[model samples]
Target chain A: MKQRNEQLPPGIRGFLIRMGQIDRRWIYLAVAVAIAAPMLARLRFPEVPGRMAQATFDAIESIPPGSRVLIAYDFDPASAAELEPMANAVLHHCASKGHRIALMALWPLGKQLADDAIRDILLEYHPEKVEGVDYVQLGFKTGNEGVIKLMSTSIAEAYAADASGKPITQIPLLEGVRTIGDFQLIASISAGTPGAQQWVQYGDSAMPDAFKFVAGTTGVQSSQLLPYYPKQMEGMLIAIKGAAEYEMLVTEKYPVTRSADRLALGRERMGPQFVAHLLLIGLIVLGNVSMLAARGWKGAAR
Target chain B: MSADRAQQSSGAPKSDTRLWIALLIFGAVGIFAGKLWRPGPLAEAYVEVVTETRVLAEVVPAPTTQGTSTDVQSAETVAPTSLEQENAPTTRVWVELDDPRFKSGELRRVEGVATEVWDERAKVDPKKAREQIAALESDAEKLSAPTDPTGLTREEFEAREAARMNALKVVESTRIVASPRDSIGIWIAALLTLGIFSFLVRDNPFYKVVESILIGVSAAYWMLVAFWSTLVPDLFAKLAPDLVRATMLPGLAPSEHPGKDFLLALIPLALGMMLLWRLAPRGAWIAVWPLAVVIGTFAGMRLTASIEADFMAQIAATMKPLVAYTSSSAEGAAAGSAFDLGGTLAGILGVVGVITVLVYFFFSLEHKGVVGKTARVGVWFLMITFGAAFGFTVMGRITLLVGRFDFLFNDWLGLSP
Candidate 1:
């Protein structure tokens, strides 16, 4: 045979190089299967909600009925999937409790989130609640935390009208509202600061007992925020679990009146969540195992 | 990336004509949205009415809990509407504080109430509020001024600002809005900002030392969070404030309670001040005494909480649920429940895979044994997580870049805007 330079021994090369180069699409498929199978099968993993989620739920629940509650929407489309349910649930619970809600946004895009939440949840569920009275949307303001600090004392300085350009003074819900402390409680569903921490710092810290406050945050942020829970923060809901737990709380006692399906949207999403969490965990382990196998074969070859 | 390819991409620019067309569309929307963003008459009246209703709702039981979309989307920050947009009888910055929905009379009342509070706060602590009002009012004036000192000499502008600052009225003391809460918040805000600033000094021992102090302070903060968030709500909200006062301190005045108002502020305050000493040469040595005490307390508390919340609790949750083993099938349904067996299995497998991958990290032990071989297998699993994380992180970074690009290309020159 003509001399040829083969890369390596055929069998060894096949195992080490050929097999090792598994297509990423296969992994994606595996992930899809891993996630979908559970939903199809209805796998029920025993999970008790974490304390942070419970605290968050309880914070919303604990405020005296009919108290003034300020809910700041601070996320965009990307975070809507994870945050919307809790945001909706929070709005639902507050509305149901007859709490006056002062709605506003911190992010430019956050306004859309507020608008979407209002259109989908409020109008659909609580049509009896009138705008500027049962609730008022101060719309979007651009000052970041400086707004919080200023509005802590002077609402007129920061906001004079609802998002539609209506004067807030006419709104029945915001009648006496002069400062951040005027509200009995502030519940911020935030992806990050100038959202949660800002409220805790500039909002809560500014007023102290003026209002009880809490937040709903993503899991990655929960670790950082854990220290704030139950103290500086009256309650905290961490990620999907927190959302699900809060959803359960709102729906349990006071269910959404309009859409029978609305109550369970968050819990329903948990199906995908469980699958996603498991998928990430699986990917982590599989990647580790493959490395070990590759290393072992390399060492043995030597 | 290539010109042809760029053109093929729908959003990419093609020719000058197309560019102009796009710009026209973008400009129209931006101007309209930007201009009309100012709250109008009808909207102003609506919000005023809503405020009154909310006032009553505060007294009733369970005020409507459902959040509204229009309300939620309304504000991003509380900063007053910008100076530029606030010009004349009406203008638009990123926000609008004036609207026509309310009778001018109603708005005047709202503004009057606000001014009353400010004036009251100023009266109580004239000295402090004077500074705050002066700092803000002058800034507002300068920013809003029509002339802008456009061609003024640098020294002149400085002199103008200084003269303005000097003209600011000061009194002995004003306690109206200057509550202990305000003081604590301001103080803490200053410290937090400074603490973050210290990090910018780089790796000097002075910086590291301050960082360590912050960590230690943060740890103490963790305890306070736990105690106040968990214990207080569970306790205080349930019990009488009087009971806490009697039991904890006996004859505890309103000011003495741990959570009473803003009393616990000293915990963060004294420690924060001590941290500042690290920057000063002489006080550096003694600064550590306070640092040690806080560090020790934080370390001890963190140890317990970390174990209970993170480690032990996590391990406990990991055990396969009873239903997983009983109901799981390859087909995967044990229906009616939200829990998914396949997902749980994936989790369980992930856990196992992690153990194997960890073995790969240890190169010390010879792979002659089965354990060593498994360890080698484990390393592969770890890479997958890194890859995923890398991909996700990259996506996040790219999004930021896209935002910057949007600002430059679209927002700035209105050229491709």
Candidate 2:
């Protein structure tokens, strides 16, 4: 490929080759503009909710109001951009339906993200709900899937106390909750390993009939989870696109008295996403064109 | 990483002075814009109340038309006087109330049925309240002693202490005031995000500092969480003698004997200590035993879980009826094809994709003739899956970029489209 670039003509052929080999910083700048410009312009696009997201929403909706729902916050800040929107939206939906949430985290930083979700979404919108009654923060437990394994058999064994060193027995919401089976539904918003996969194995597979399970995961992680969709996993929200679509469904059904930004972060973020994707596609096309043009010039030279 | 690598690459910038100056200017603009940014109007639901004002009781018993209702009425009547007496003093002592309603034997029987009627409401069936009352009584009994005097049953004691430690402080009234710390947090977050994104231009000191801080924070945070959440609860609390635990964490009530999980907890603690032996100058080979245990455990768990969840389950799901003939379909109608051609075709293609991909992976046979053609088809399927995955990955990265941009523009700059 390098030799081919050098053999091209010194005029346009040379320029095409140079374009193909342009500094990565320039591409970065192009991407930044592509994303920022669309965001600034407030470009809105319609999203058709996918089957997986619909299934996820349906699963949560199917559960009786005030049912115990265990939400495992399993991603860090690194993947928060991809996972948090859906996490927030899901929490909002759960809270709106008056579900008792048992929030836990597998990753250390995931606890902070969960706290953010609690403070921003759960607390902000649903101030009427009392902590330890409406919801309980289990915080981030170490041992990864080992925590899930312990939780499946006995949640008390896994977490003796809530995040703030409170006993689980004292939590009003978790009154009779003994194990993961005690919950009516389980939702895990995850990024990588020790995430949705671990939950599926320990929480779903271990007790398939115990509770319904759903996942909101990064786009890259979605492929790994596809096998479990609507089977082991009742529903799945794939990345921000899924988050946006699910948000639309949720807000349309159960509107909240909050800023549109707070209610629809995923959809709001999608504008930049669309433009960036277009830019990427354009770059790919340009690279391909440059490659083909250079090849033709080299053939003529030969 | 880029700074070091850029030095060896042809794309290295001549100087970073301009970049630093630009970043400083951007930072200034961000801080100034953030100061100008005002929070949106609070929802009508957000009613402010002073911190010490306890307006409404947190939990209200479910309305019932039975003996339980009578009991609730009596409790309500008596509650104000008792609450006033308790609240009279500036410093209130946490008291465990003894419910004289149920005797010990009756309480145990009711406790046995608690889990069964946990989800069922007492309003529907009055008998369910017996279980609830039993649970409430047991909770009170557990609080009788937060710490075990003897080393026989610490689990119950610790649970009570955890509850006591985690008790929610009752507030007189509620307020949802937006704190100034929140705005400062946004500014810090925006600045950090900018510092990290600055790498897109070129590796700079700002990015390096933020990156280093992130790494350090991550390590420290992980250590803290692991120690507090796992080592304390699962290992130390389970294996260490009550005296040691009491001495180490005086704030925490002492638990009795580790109970049934003591041996189970000890094994892992020993293994972990052995794993740490690698830090020693000599006999570091002892760590291999624990390392092997960890690896073997993970490998075994992954092997079984993946085969069942990922492999077998996937294959089962893929093996769908090629013809989707519903019960409602007419006798003459072409099975599944008549109702949903798209679904039927998709099912067939999925089955084909799986077979061809499997055949392609089966390299024991030579790639020639029919096998070669199938292999080519398999390659096409693989390419499509990869392409889709690549698209998703790109979307994920773009979303991250968008989130940062949103913070910068919406939160920091207060810019609206």
* Interface RMSD (Å), every candidate: 12.8, 1.5
TM-score for every candidate vs. truth?
0.42, 0.65
Q: List RMSD in Å for every model shown.
A: 21.8, 15.3
Q: After superposition, how far is residue B388 of candidate 2 from its true place, in Å?
A: 1.2
True contacts kept of each: 0.00, 0.93
Poorest lDDT segment (10 consecutive residues) of candidate 1 chain B? B43-52
Quote model 2's TM-score. 0.65
Each model's lDDT comes to 0.60, 0.74
Residue by residue across B1-417, what tens digits does model 2's lDDT show?
766666634544345446645755985685455445643321111112232211111122324435342222322222234557764222111111232322321111122222211121111111223344455456555545456546546777677566664542221112233345555666778778878877776666789899999999999999998887678777776676454444554334434654766888979878988999999999999999998998999999999989987799777778788865434545655543345677678889999999999889986889899999999899999999999889889889888778777667765665552
Off by over 4 Å in 1: A1-21, A32-47, A295-302, B1-417
User: How good is the docking of model 1, by CAPRI class?
Assistant: incorrect
Q: What are the per-model DockQ values?
A: 0.05, 0.60
